[model samples]
Structures are given as C-alpha cells and as structure tokens.
Target: MNQNKLQSLMLCLLFYSNVSVYPVTPETIHIIISEDKTMLSEWEIPEELTLDTLESKIGTHDRTNETEDSIKYIWDHLGIVAKFSKNSKFLNKLTVFYATTLKNEEPKQNFKGKMNFFSSDPNQKVEATYKGWICRFKLGNRSLYGICKGENRNLEQIDILSK
Candidate 1:
C-alpha cells in the first residue's frame, strides 16, 4: 500500500473512537491497544468470540472448515476468517483480508474500521506509522501478534494470531 494511505489508515484506527474496549453500540469499528500498551483488542471481534457468540455479532458465516486441530469460520463478504482450536470455543486466530479485488480496481468495501495503538509510558512506546513493525500485545491470557502482509504493493491481509 502507499505510504500516505497506510498513515491515513493508522490515524483513523487510533482516533476514530474513544470508547472503552468493549463498546456496546459502536458508531465506528476499531481495535485499540490498552493505555499501558501491553493489551490490544478489536472488541467488535472481542477476545472472547466463540462458536456460541459468533453468529450474534457477525451474522452467519459463508463457509466453515474443520481440521484435526482447528475450525475456521469464513465470511467472504466481510473478508474475515475467524479460527478456533478444535477443542476450544475462543478465537485462536483472526484474519482480515484487505486486497479483495484485482489490481487497479477500487478497493472492495472491506471492514470499514479503524485501529489505535499508543503508549503513555516513555519506555514502552510503539509506532503507529510503522513500515513493517510487528504489533505485539496480549489477547486475553495469550500473547498475540498482528501482522500485515502485502502482495504487489497492495495490502493483502492482517492476521492476528497467538504468539
């Protein structure tokens, strides 16, 4: 993605909403890091998202796949794939695809959301304008990382997964 556009996206992510982590009726979607920088969340998808609560928040999935150790719920229109351990109900991974169309075409109407990452502690600051920095934080009781992958200069996906 273009540098200017990436910066713009980060800005929107950080300041689009100021509500607490679990917003009841969100006006704008967002993922926010805790004030201390050790925790991160996209509460719309929440740390506790599971098989039981999935449909209520995201509606029905378009597809589902289960393997020996995991299950995946895919929403094609929303470009999200939520994963869970076979024996667990909570999300083990969440994938958000961004480059949904062909090259030179307009960006698809993706998850119109924002993200905010900040730290008040001088020793723990993270850059929101990172070129390829790993965004690391805690997701519930697990350590997690959010990574952005690209192809042909287009942002392809953001994967938030256990570390």
Candidate 2:
C-alpha cells in the first residue's frame, strides 16, 4: 500500500511540473546545390528537374496542390515542398521547413562551404540541429513586409530558387 501510494504521488508531481515527457522527432530533407547558388540538386536528382521528372529522383510526393500558374509538390515526412510552373513544369523553387511545433515538421541541414546555396554566405546558419534551434542566414527573393522574414527563426522554411 505504501509503495503504491508513493508511485502515485511521484506520477502526480511529474505531471504537474510542466515537463515534456515525449520529445518530437523532426522530419528531414537533404539537398545539394550548385556553386553559383542558382541551381539545386541531390544525390540522384539532377541540377534542374521538372514537375514530371521530380518523382524520378526523390520519389513521389506525399500530397500536391496546383494553381493555373504554379504547382506545389509536398513531402510531409521528408519536410520538402517543391514549387514549379504549370506551363513550363520546371522547378521554380523548393522550401525546407523543420519547426514541428507549429505544423509538426523536422529538418536536417548538412551543407558544407560551397556546397549548398547558403544564406548568401557559407558561414551562415541554416538548420537547427537536435541539440538546439537555428536561424536562416539570408532571406530569398520574397516579401519581407517590414522586418526580415525567416530571419532568426527556427528554420521554418526556405525557398531555393532555380536559375
């Protein structure tokens, strides 16, 4: 009886302490970029891929949506969203998001100097490791509104534009 009561007390204390008992595992995607920061690629993926050929490299997307002008191919578990032109079918840009709290996403950054189109500079921070959070170095050609968008945030997503 005493042991049962002790265990129950311990469980109640832990639950009331506001401690997270379960940690979320993040989804990840890996990309290889060109030296000029204009092209994007991967292990088996080509430098430039169209909507029709994207699946041949990275496999089929989890879900997709389209507009008259553009199409989006999303891989939820892999944390990738490739956007392309509807007429040309050529890839316009791809986004990588990792923060799962807001949308249950995970990210893995494994770029070296001159490898990936870093945040305009190779010394910039790109991904949040399992140890802690990280910020995207530079913002792409997107609307910043008043402040720098995607700056100093936990790498929610990024647009890798094509040439």
Top candidate, metric lDDT: 1
lDDT for each residue of candidate 1 in 1-163, tens digit (9 for 90 to 100): 6999999988887764422222323225455654423222343445566765755554566667777898777765455677788887788867655555522222234645555554455565443322464444443333435444443234455564431
lDDT agreement of model 1 with the native: 0.53
Summarize candidate 2's per-residue lDDT along 17-76 as a digit string, tens digits.
423221111222345443334332434455567766665544566667777887777766
Cα shift from native, residue 87, model 1 (Å): 1.7
lDDT of 2 at 75: 63
Model 1 is weakest, by summed lDDT over 10 consecutive residues, at: 18-27
Off by over 4 Å in 2: 1-29, 37-47, 100-152
**Candidate 1: how large is its RMSD?**
14.2
